[model samples]
Target chain A: MKSVEDINEKIREGSVCVVTAEEMKEIVKELGAEKAAEEVDVVTTGTFGAMCSTGVFLNFGHSDPPIRMQRVWLNDVEAYTGIAAVDAYLGATQQSEKAEDYGGAHVIEELLKGEEVELKAISKGTDCYPAKEVRTVITLEDLNFAEMVNPRNAYQRYNAATNSSDRLLRTYMGTLLPNFGNVTFAGCGEISPLNNDPEFRTIGIGTKILLCGGKGYIVGHGTQHCPGYATLMVKGSLKSMDPEFLRAAYMPGYGVTMFVGIGIPIPVLDSKMAEKLAVRDEEIKTKILDFGVQRRDRPVVREVTYAELKSGRIEINGEEVRVSPLSSVYMARKIMEELKRRIERGEFLLTFPVERLTPGKALKPMKTAIKLVKSVMSEAIVISPETSVEIAAKIMIEKGVNHLPVVENGKLVGIVTSWDVAKAVAMGKTGKVGEIMTKRVIVTYPEEAVELAAKKMEENDISALPVVDKSMRVLGIVTSEDLSKLLAR
Target chain B: MFLRLRFDSKAVRKPVISAVTLKTSALINIIKAEVGPRRGELIVEVDDSIAEKVEKAFEELGVEVLRLKEKVERNERCVHCGACISICPVEAIVLQDGRVEFLDKCVLCGNCVKVCPVKALKLPTT
Candidate 1:
């Protein structure tokens, strides 16, 4: 029984590594793009976050003061966080498996090592829905894990010729989503149906424990259970209301949050956990309300004696079992299948302590919240505004450059469009160069991430930003006109 | 299945009419799954007034009478689970010694088969 810390350390020490977009490109460059594409197989789309924010919850207990605590709440946390990450990692890894020399288990082993993967966000949200983005970097490290657990890869050699329409990677991605999501729903069940991504395995049938002996049983869909729900959240403004009135009427806990990996299923832990959590929650809340905020002492795992374990009857395979240290999104699926088998056989008697399971032991680092912002432009070409009217004409004539940025003192000061240059010449101002320059500059600092750049562009009603450094020196430029091109294969 | 009744002729004012239909062997197999096999004779006894009503309704429906019978004995037994008693549009079933006795007023529509708990009640095959 390794602790979470211990297990993480071990994984960190493993030889597997993830690959980034540049590394993948290098592989493609070495082995022709067509050949490189042939070696890898895609698994599935990774998980994604919908709403990733948290709010403070106040728990009223029997203690001295009402406990004001920070409770993480979201509609579907596990699917969005750890599971999503694994999904992304696995999907990318599967694509990497197509590498000619790398095949099957070997690829999976490599992915576990970790790779530098660049996930660029494609889009953001509208008023009705949360943000949505498509990440498009498949690395060698991701390929390793994908090939390892993939059922098809597990059964057949990478080079082995097989006839099956289900061999396509896109189909594989579809299969993984439902099954993984189902585990998040049903607690546990068989994965073979999902692994095969059978046409009929459309619904998630929960564990059916027969009180009688026969296989004749009822099937329950875990999706039917609503994990946690709240009244619609109000986000706009509450400043006008009186403080006491606001406090009484409002439950501050009603905010949208992105759920991390799957949470621990409510049933697996020791009985005292809920009680302990309840007590700790109350203590933390009291301390917070008393002095505005207080930190809780980290909890220690309580050891159970052999006698206590036997008496408690929390056993798996006839031996006492405790909460698993950390389960990957894939591992979580395996556990669910085991649970379903035990339940159907009437072997599972102990209750699950929690309703959710997290893929990793700890929450994802907050920095992961910063996803790569995508550019809107598909094509771009750089041109200088200072070029002579005739030179600009010649460049535009030959290269089809649509926009040109004006540079002064190594800083982008303005932009002159080909359209502008043509118009300036028609209006008798082209050759002067300075007269045609548009001085209203839209620029983004290199230190600022893609998301912030996008926001600033949106606010200013601009299409492109000249990338600048700390000293306002121009590095490169991004424009809506050329963004799509920059991101294209 | 059969029905045997001992009744005064005057009690059945109009000519007492009885009808029956033949069913397939598959029907029997289905019934057997739900209910036990037939045993003693099935007996039906009906009052004259209800018997006249059943005859009129069946006649108006343009259904041909299978067989007009005064009495017939067949090996069939019904554990009066009250299925037939509750199902009959008319009060036609009388229970005695855990057996069901239907009156002549039975329309013989085979509805009891549809409602039988164990499918103990069924239409007889020719």
Candidate 2:
């Protein structure tokens, strides 16, 4: 058996022959693991997917007066500045408080493009750091260190999601079309790194890898890592993380997601390792669940092989469903090819794991609690019907709210939204709230399910619904934002 | 005269050129043909004298004649992720200068539409 030292010597001499996980399978099948192990020096594994827990640590070299940033924002997107002076952690999923569309991922992308991003920070003046606030533009070059440390990434395999109910479900799986119109799954199937390795083997801590476009190393096993299933779960840290190697992605209807760069180097230590590297798409399997169910114990409708998923279609409960990958298989293949090119040019080398991951418990689902409408129904702001459209608009603008429920004499009358105001202004028919308000208002009861409220909003193409009591007294309001926040939680 | 034809399951696989040639041989000359998996558009130059006859012939063969337009529509689903920028061969789809701009250089090749992960970009068919 070739040892790690032998692999290193081969890499140094440029005598190592490498194949992708996909190609190694054929080679192993043709030549057998024993023969393939002797011939192949390294097997490269790759996966490209949205890792939400990813974030970057940036050290903006001490400012002129050097303020220890207490509050930091990049492009209006907040960054955690609690770490150190002028250092902040920007998470992928953190959305801008001012602009809902902008997120930390967008900030990362702007930095990657070499574009100047507006950096704003506020801090209480200290004797050592006199400045209280700083607003300026900075590029990646301005940072002393910009490193990405993802707590969890590169899931070995993931479950596919579909909707069994009649309403469309907005989920991390991309919008699950109603009535199983589509199935959304993530991962590169056969080309996935963990699917190839199946075990830690040479993929533990300290293993050199391709992170984004730069060289990185496996730091440790990712959080929520479960290893009993034949897949390797690991997180990698970049050496000199460059913007070119990373991508910031935004999912429509969903929030921001980070496209993590991951490449694993497998040393052919023995026949068993070689065999594991040769696993194919048909060999990898994952469970498919109906995300429509609100409870944590959502049933697994069926088990599907990656081969079936990659084919773009699958059958669940005797119904034909179209399948699309939320993660880009095309990008995954591109990463594998790029990694191969690096290895062939002798630009990348294999490194042994300094530490191995221990077995971890499986992740438990969050239990369904009280209905959201009831929970959030207590403190909703209400406006009077006699309140002028202009006044209603003012209240909405001042409160940064989209919907204003019109209540008269402690009873719900109608509702007015920012869109209604804009439309009324455009139509030159602005006056009292009663004149322009939607009288046939859609209302939800506090006792109903949050999913039902969301479905009503989606069905009526409205953003907010007033939660009312049996006597029609306005209790609270549930908006699309609230539903999205609940789902995110 | 250009025709934007949407083929049904029955007519998708049928030979269009052969059938049209046999029916209206010298009346129509196809200048550009863009065919996707389920639909096709043909920019054809019909002899002005027999244009009416050619239209009638295509209608008989169940080929739809549609009006052509030059605008590419970006639906509300566009999150402006800029995934389509790199794949545009003509640099028509660009997000470099802080905003997504669909330049006049677009050839309506639909490459951006295909690459868009959110299915946001739509090219005018007719």
Q: State the C-alpha lDDT per candidate.
A: 0.30, 0.74
Ten residues in sequence with the least summed lDDT for candidate 1 chain A: A153-162
DockQ, candidate 2, comes to 0.06
Model 2 chain B lowest lDDT segment of ten = B90-99
Question: Tens-digit lDDT track for model 1 on A12-54?
Answer: 4441122222233354446544543333211110111111121
Interface C-alpha RMSD per candidate, 1 decimal: 27.9, 9.5
The candidates score, on chain A by TM-score, as follows 0.27, 0.76
lDDT of 2 by residue, B1-126 (tens): 444455554555678656776787745555557676776666565555666666676667677765333546797545443445544544566543324568754556675675454456798855
Best by TM-score: 2
User: For candidate 1, lDDT tens digit of each residue in B13-112?
Assistant: 3222333212111111111111113221123333444444443443443432232242112222222223234334334554443245667555454655
Q: What is the lDDT of residue B66 in candidate 1?
A: 32
Off by over 4 Å in 1: A1-363, A366-386, A485-489, B1-126
Give lDDT tens digits, candidate 2, residues A1-489: 988888777767888788887788899999999999999988877777777878888888888798999999998899998888988999889988886556998788778667899999999989998999999999887888878777777787888888887776666666676787777777777777767666677778777788876777667777778753433333333335555446666555577777776777788899998888878778888999988776566779899988898665688778767666656555566677788777777788677888866656686867656575887554567887677778887888888898888888888888888999999989987788888888888888887778778878888989889889889998888888878777688
The alpha-carbon deviation from the true structure for residue B62 of candidate 1, after best TM-score superposition, in angstroms, is: 99
List DockQ for all candidates.
0.00, 0.06
Off by more than 4 A, model 2 = A228-245, A365-489, B1-126
